[model samples]
Target: MIRKMELKDREAFVAMANEFYHSDAVLHSIPESNIEKTFDELMAGSPYIDGYIFECDGEKAGYSLLSITYSNEAGGLVVWVEEIYILPKFQGRGIGKEYMDFVEEAYKDKAARIRLEVEEENERAIKIYEKKGYRQLDYLQMYKGK
Candidate 1:
């Protein structure tokens, strides 16, 4: 089951987030600096971000953090799948497909398009997304951080 993230799910969020990014040496051993406040605010709910916790067989399995925005091109709300993390042990069991399907049902009426990005080298993830009908865009992603 996929449900709205609660402040009480902070530990799960932190754990899954770190595990998901474990390959990034820079963040491997780092603690989340604002997860407490972040989870609190997110659980409070808003028009912007939507965070969900996925449970499998009555246990915490993973999460999906989404960002929503209006897009003239999309002709409705566009949502970015900022992150989706499933515990290593829970992977390769079709849980991801179910989780994504849940997201679609939850936002179908409110969103025009759902999108996500994967690391260029993560071939497994790329294949999964492709199998789910996601395609690569011709545009490059450019970003600036302060």
Candidate 2:
């Protein structure tokens, strides 16, 4: 099952997030401070962000973070799937596809597009995403962060 993240989920969420950032799934590790800040932002009821915790047999299995933004090119609201991480033990059980389905169903009416970024080297994830009908965007993504 997947549900909105709550304050009580902090410990598990942090552990999983830290693992995710440090694993091959990501390009680099982020400071733990950033993880804490993300939790705080999610808990603060921010309108632009949403967090969900995935459960398997009543155990915390993983988490996903999503961000919302308006895109003129997309002609409406865009739902950016910022992060998705499943515990190592639960990795092959089709949960990722379930999460994708959930996101699609949840935003079908409100969003013009559902977007996400995947590391080019992460071939496994790329296959799953491609099977789910996600296509690569040709433009290079760049950001200037403070």
Candidate 3:
């Protein structure tokens, strides 16, 4: 099931975030020293950011973090999927598709667009995205390097 993360989920969230971030397939890993502090500062139950926890039979199975933004171009709210991770054992159970379906329905009326980025090398993820009808956009994502 899909539900907004609650305070009680903090420890679980942190652990999952850490595990997902450090996986060899994950190209974007936060500094080892700042994980907790960074999560606290930016994701401490902020309204602008929605962290969704996925559960199966009451067990924490995965999570997806989404951020809302005001896009003048869209002239409305836009949603971005910051990160999505399903635990190792739970992989290939259609959980990711279910999560995307939940996200699509949740934002159907409120968001002008929903966006996510995937690494070129993550072929499994790419297939899921393509099957879900997501198309590659022309614009590239850029960030100011440290």
How displaced is residue 89 in candidate 2, in Å? 0.3
Stretches of model 2 off by over 4 angstroms after superposition: none
Better candidate number, 2 or 3, judged by lDDT: 2
Candidate 2 lDDT, 27-119, residue by residue in tens: 889999999999999999998999999999789999999999999999999999999999999989999999999999999999999999998
| Backbone collision tally, model 1 | 0
How would you encode candidate 3's per-residue C-alpha lDDT over 1-146 as one tens digit per residue? Answer: 88887767778888888888988557867764555664564556666788888998679998888889989888899999888989988889989999988999999999998889888888998898899899999996688965
Residue runs of model 1 more than 4 Å from their true location after superposition: 24-31
Where's the lowest-lDDT run of ten residues in candidate 1?
23-32
Better of 1 and 2 by lDDT: 2
Write down the TM-score of every candidate.
Answer: 0.87, 0.97, 0.88
Higher-scoring candidate on TM-score, 2 or 3: 2
User: If ranked by lDDT, best first, what sequence of candidates would result?
Assistant: 2, 3, 1
Q: Candidate 1's residue-wise lDDT over 20-123, tens digit each? A: 65664122344466555556668778778889898888899888889899999989999888788888778888878887788788889999999888777778
Looking at model 1, residue 101 earns an lDDT score of 81
Ranking by TM-score: 2, 3, 1
Candidate 1, residue 69: the lDDT equals 95
